[model samples]
Target: MEKRVHRPTAWHVTHWSSDPFSLGAYSALLPGGTPQHRTALGQVLHERLVIAGEACNAGAPAMTHGAWNDGLRAAEAALSAGARKVIVIGAGCAGLAAAQRLRAEGIDCTVLEARGRTGGRTHTVELGGVKADEGAAWLQHFAENPLAAVALQHGLACIETDFSCPLAAASDGDLPDVDAAWIALTKRLDRRLTLAEAINRYMVTLEPAHARATQFAIDANLVLEACLPVERLSVSALDEEGVGYGDRMLPGGYSELVDLLAKRLDIRLNTPVMRIDWSSTGVKVNDEVCDFCICTVPVGVLKALHFTPALPETQQQALAHLGMGKLEKVILQFDGRWWPYSRSGYLRWYDQPASWGEWLDLTDAVGKPTIAGLIAADAIERQFSGRTDEQIAMAATEALQAWAAAIRPTP
Candidate 1:
């Protein structure tokens, strides 16, 4: 590398995978699991208890809007179950959305959040003198997403983004055929296969250059989109999520929407429900009893929490089959815009141990010279193992410098 990347004045790093409240960045179905696993987890228990989240939403699992929709439906279902009072767990999108609906309906509801703040994974804090949504920032499938309109109502502007790959100058001419082969293989398969296995089996059949391209596509797109490492992702989920990118983001931060939905709702912060005891007529969340319970905690947290009398075998199996994505971020806020402003839209793909390959253009969102590198899938464990936050950030910065040197050479 000919050029050196300038040091940032400030930075932030996330460890959602290690956060006990989250236990993961989000949820993923295991290799052998199907959408039915989500259906099972979403199933209402004893007619008075329900588990809701993106993982429970089979239609759009592992998305903010999916979790939002899940909450709305969960509230309605709880009402139909003859519940007078409800206890919603987690303060994230789904729980807040559920509580919001209950508030509008004039129902008695209380939200228990383990964290001191609301917005669960949708956290936003000031960095570089601007707001940065630490967890989610995009409103994907905006045309039909309910939150898209709601964001405008909250006075949050929707910044339209280009999903088209901006990193590479030209599209791989052979890529479409390679993707088609992946689609065909996933669709025609009768058995279970991890994404890594499928990729390996398929890549072996391709020419050397095409095989390299295959890895690039997986690292550059699928892994980032899934927010999980290749080895843990299910082939079925890869097929189901298809190919989609966030077309818009809220420069004001996604937490604005969470706050809007949480308005006037009874939310108890720093309250964690370690055990949920439920029967035919009522549910006990820790020490408090409610007529109904909507457990919206992530699958990772749900797996660890205790349940009196035990959850049904089917639901237990569903929880076991569910996987969590190890999504971590390293954000660098430089004193000045030393990097190419034009390269903001151009994307880069990095392999494990390479550090900070997926650089996000936060130049517009953060209103400063900021770049966010995403570490997902198995790479997260590798990056975090025996490394401090400062060390991780430096490695990411070095990767950025290397990329800059490659793109803009110096004498």
Candidate 2:
């Protein structure tokens, strides 16, 4: 904390307070579950009410692009159901995407957003005259992600980032190597085993040193990538559904993509939907009657909404099974760059048990002295959640200083 260079000149947190739909960042998949659970959560009720968002996407749940794709699917479903006028709720990426697709198809639809802006969780803000994405920053699997196409179409520049971090290289001592065992186990894992169980079983067979290193790598990977601890994650689900290796960042921030999607769309801002009444005849959103309605609100917000006659018991149970994961970032802008700039965009520290160890170096991309410290995992997020902004910033400052000191201790 006494390090002068590590101290941040300015900082900002995108808590998404005004938008209830983005309660956290996005929804998290539970163990032994498929995206089918998410799709089922988006089931159309009575042929009048349709649910759409990243939560409803079976392919890429909890992603901005997934939300956009889900919007298109919902719009198509509404049109196929012979809907004349459709009402889309929550003007985030999902709502805006649905409205844009509906307009393209010559379908009459209106987008009602609770906030006075678009992009939902994808908010871009200026810090020290440089733009940074507060939420939904990366385009994972850019070649396959639909958002990449939109970015390319709009002439937005994207910088590919490699998030791979080797713990062996970072660790001072010679750690045990579990690469062979890990590869062998991953090649043929028991579908019945949870990620934690699988990892524990593998660790028990390894040497004590190797086991410790293996455990650290597994735990860090799960907490850093999935935003969940190993126990809550499914090994089979992860093995079957691999997170693509490639990721890219929008140098101009994600709001640019949102801006592109918002053009020529009927988006009504600051109009929050209080209640919904749906039946075979039609659906009414806040007393506004429409042939069909698409609810793109976040799962947290959706659960709180009042439904006329209430949702089915099965649907209610499905909703209860789904839960949100907490993930926050502490972005610090320094007077000068202290961290080494390299092709590897991420830095991981295993010193603290869930502090802001993983950081994204934005110096190269933003052309500024900024580093965003990612605080993932339930325990870590909860710890930071209870602290004030000043406290969190101080903790981050200490962590960064420690990281720098460890990497290159002063004489």
Candidate 3:
């Protein structure tokens, strides 16, 4: 790549894939979700109730912009008939944005949030003396993210991160020394990714029927081996979306974006909406009757909550059909760097010899002690599930030592 242009001097990285609240970073469609599910999920109920999320926008779903677009479309739908009253649940990116837009369009809207603070999965926490994004970090498709423009309008800072850096091996010590083979595998994966982008672009021009079927096929091929399949994904949802390009890091913290959106909105913290009575013209929330209601809770939470009057069997089935991805990010602050031969700022340790799973260095944060994090949702769940923090840490240290030996770099 240097042959084509000058390389940058610095970079940053993060691992939100494993956060408990997030389970996995963003929403992903599984093998069971059909177009009918997404369509049903978003279908306006008697011009009254509408669901919107990254999950709603099949094409751009699981992205910040997708959430924004969903909110806007929902608001537009609500206001089309000059509806005067509206209620929005969840104060995260989607809910807040929906309220703001509805307010702008002269529709009366209120934002309700279950957490004490807004920004559901998008959260920032203090770690090692610096504010870090504990949840969603990357601001994807910046050019289209209304939140990005909002960030700029508010003078919030943003940083760019490159995605082509080398990935480290996570295989266990006993696993055959497949570093070279793994590198080749990584290159092959990159090529396949490029191919996917081109094909997706081409998919845009095809007829809806053709495009939907093709996308389902492509998703099936791309779904991770151990994870859910893509045939369950909603093809109709991906049809109307356009490609988004700008991707950047929120230097201050992505959670701050959620906070910014939450300002001036009516939010109730720790007030998880346990049930929704949607059987009548007005929905009931914990015995309170409201003119309208919008639920932006994660599907997981929604699936667990008891619904009064019960959802339509089809809707319940749709909820049951969707799958949640599991990811875990375990951060360990070290007194100093360990690995030698630092060609790349980030390192990847894979196919671990021990039970700790894959590890990586969070080498480029703004502050101290050279923090590194390990991630392997399945492994973490298997070895550390219900185990004490000490057990998890000890397991991690052993894994790190093995990774150090793999590169054979001076401590």
Candidate 4:
């Protein structure tokens, strides 16, 4: 990997992993959605074949808590319908949660997981003896989030991170209070216009001279938080949804919740369900028959599975219209803390539009010299997908060094 140190700091990219199918990391409402339409999307089929997952949750889709809540809802429905034996496909957050609830209610159920391990998209990996999350890192709405309640109940280490740190520069004089400007623009954003149009108009109105640095900071914040460019996002949807504030991290890892939910459950690992035969009698998952079934697989994986009598036209249409946001993370380890440490658990760079600019510092939380950088936007994600880990790491290091240099004062 290409290494660049502004002041002789030591660090190395220890390990990294990419999830090609993590398209649903952040779900967006894209410009179209009514109450009736969202309700229809979450409907269960024939009372015996139920669908539950992050994508199936219309209220809060593309979130870990959403998946868990959906699983609980599905389990309740199945039990109320007199379902004694149920088959839950995919032992991810949703599947595990449903099974847990079912077991609590004295209902018989089995969880079939495609992968050998559980947690699904919430994967935690160890780098240089320190555990860090590879997927679904933070609790966006910690105070109000149910997952946070569970973590707190279990005595897991949780640290609150300030995501709204003021914009920084090499000299204090050059730094503008961009946070105030951004909040003002968001407050007055026209709901009718797309996010891209609204952002452009706001920039022209506020920064008539079009300062490149200010624009970069604005775009970087949007991409880092939303995981997609403003052009593809909807102003009304984003405003109404309002990406929850006050994020918190699990120092131990996000998989702790998974382990808690999967306790003593009948889980079959490395078992891929190829087909689901939901006939008039009951649901059959690749020869394993049950009174009811809760399919909580990812949207992409769900689309690939074969059905005996085919999915309903409405479901097919919903899947076709719904799209997943693309995102990837690059984790780096260093011999000791190199970057400036602060309670604000992140570092932002204005080098490139889609560079690995948003980095999460784990030094304070995990007490380790590790940081994970996020790469968002479709174009940059695809570009990184084609290159080697070394190339990506080198680019990230260069961008980080440039940012450090830009913010450091002259000796």
Candidate 5:
């Protein structure tokens, strides 16, 4: 068994999502907005400029296909304008998708990116000579997800995975005893969904004003995860749609997905958009102007970036009110699966039960011995803040050990 500690060398990323110009990898919405807001945001302004991203699609928001569809929708608006030339912003999945749609319609478009590469947040790195995804890992629920169809249409290969796991919660030493926790969590989730469904049915029978008042109650508890309370999410948030916990993984990585989507498009890289001057004749990037503009940048970036003619106070207020929280995942490698537990993918620990460091065991796709550790925002912040690699590894190992001990009895 060979144990190796992996660390980022020079921040090793080619995805423009992390670039200051882009601000975020993709769009995610918070609470307080209706489906109408999403529609209004995507509308083409006077056949000159339009906005598109995951946020535009109330049904498919926050997924790759959501952005893809949004791009096509925007391109259709541009194509109808009778404009020969158009400017596509951000070469991520959405931007590339828009450009492709416009090109197919025989419309001339130029893609501008802030970073030297495309595929916004979808990037990959060679870890132990195997591709590892740095962004957008899963094609959650491929049955209904449009990305799978798109990937297949583009001749990109995808790996269907059986992501079922032996455990669900945190572990102490090797793997935690998550039966009780799982049961509890499942019960709460089921109840929440049932309640939500009931509310939906009732809303159909109620008057408009009454239905609107009841929606707040239904939205509050649809999701089981406490970190992201479903109540604080948009009322139009999509249901689970039959994708639970884990699903298919892209072995070739998100970068491959991006590469597949970026075919036959004129993408200008390393040209960071400092300001979007939309008040004048058309949108301007780096002082260059164009006929029409399609913005695929994340909402966080839109809120952060300075807009010429200044964004309307209402839009600015919406941007400020609706925002995404921080999420981080830390991948840890092991010499051998010294997990000391007889489980496959997941572990749950509850030493203090603070929800600080919930982790999963990501082994090699071929069932070889390797580990990809995960930690979210609060958990990662609690333990990994300003820590060295060695320190992080030790801390992680110790946490795993405690988790395993909690779940299983000592021999």
Candidate 6:
């Protein structure tokens, strides 16, 4: 077995949770929250002010496609109400989509983005020499995802990723069974419970050995998929979300779709709208006033923006109930492929249970020597608390080397 640790040629890390414009990676429901909160946020106020984004998209919250669809819906609502001039806030997928719809219908629309760049959470950057998504990368539930059709339309190659396969470093036990146990527990719940509370209840029913394995198995997907830590996630939240086996990725990066949506649209980047003052007659976003305003900012960062007259009671409650997901990523580019090219397309390193749970191999997917490691749940807190980007890279590197040493050791 190779004892030497291989350092990366280049590395990139994401701190979505700390970004002032984002606050977190994605949207989720808190312990006492429900889908009705998302519905309430999507409701238009005064027939001239509309709010749209993934958080407002109950059918497919936390996905870019959901944001796109909601953006379109918001624009349609404003147009149907005879809106002429419009302001769409946040130049992410939702903002761009809403602007695109308005422009097509000949409604004068302008998009204001807080950052210098567009794409919101769907950022794409270089992780070595390869083009990769710094934020979202997957077209989850691809069979039903609009991104699949959009990718094909744009001539971008979409590859299916089967998550069931894993190049495990001695898995504790059948993970799916443990996953089933979680699903079963959700059904018999008599009251609202945080994920952490429910897990403790389940742990008492198992032997010490089995309990450890169960912990490893459940932790594998809990925060990694939901993006929220156990304490923040509601047990009932899973019941509202859609789960399926179909998944796909865009090798050219998700920004390609964003570009297509943003084409010919008037977007003012780096221009943050600090305050939104709206009335029954018109809407004022900062100094610019318009017939209507569509705010597509992430729910996590909404509280920072001042709204004159305050939002409706329902919107306020929804904001309080919704949560931001804590998932972060560390994409490393190596001189060569040091890890085993497993049929699973991913790895589960049980040896480094706490820090490293799952990793996606992108060598085959992106045709480069790259691997993407996830930071979620408590790992986001433990690993990123006071670490620099270099330090974060180092920590993730240590976990990666441990996996390589065990699975594809050099002779």
104-189: candidate 1 lDDT, tens digit per residue: 88889999999999988888777768877778767878877888879877678887666554553112232233354445545544
Q: In model 4, which residue pairs have backbone atoms overlapping below 3 Å?
A: none
lDDT of each: 0.76, 0.74, 0.56, 0.70, 0.59, 0.81
Q: What TM-score quantifies how close candidate 1 is to the native fold?
A: 0.91
Candidate 6: Cα lDDT at 235: 70
lDDT tens digits, residue span 73-103, model 3: 7777777645677778777677877888877
In model 4, where do residues sit more than 4 Å from their true spots?
A: 1-24, 31-38, 166-177, 184-190, 193-218, 240-245, 382-385, 409-411
Clashes of 5: 27
**Sort order, lDDT high to low:** 6, 1, 2, 4, 5, 3
lDDT of 4 by residue, 26-135 (tens): 45445443323334555788888877887777666667888888888889889888999999997887888899899998899999988888988888877777779888
Best by lDDT: 6
**What are the per-residue Cα lDDT tens digits for candidate 2 across 75-173?**
888878888899999888888888988898888989898888888878888889888888888887778888898898878989887765432223344
Which portions of model 2 show Cα errors greater than 4 Å? 1-5, 16-19, 165-190, 193-206, 234-243, 381-386
TM-score each candidate. Answer: 0.91, 0.89, 0.72, 0.86, 0.74, 0.93
Residue 249, model 5, lDDT: 67
Error of 4 at 313 (Å): 3.4
Candidate 1 deviation (Cα RMSD): 3.1
Candidate 4 vs 6: which has more TM-score: 6
Q: Each candidate: RMSD to true structure?
A: 3.1, 3.0, 9.9, 3.8, 8.0, 2.4
Give, for candidate 6, the lowest lDDT window spanning 10 residues.
170-179
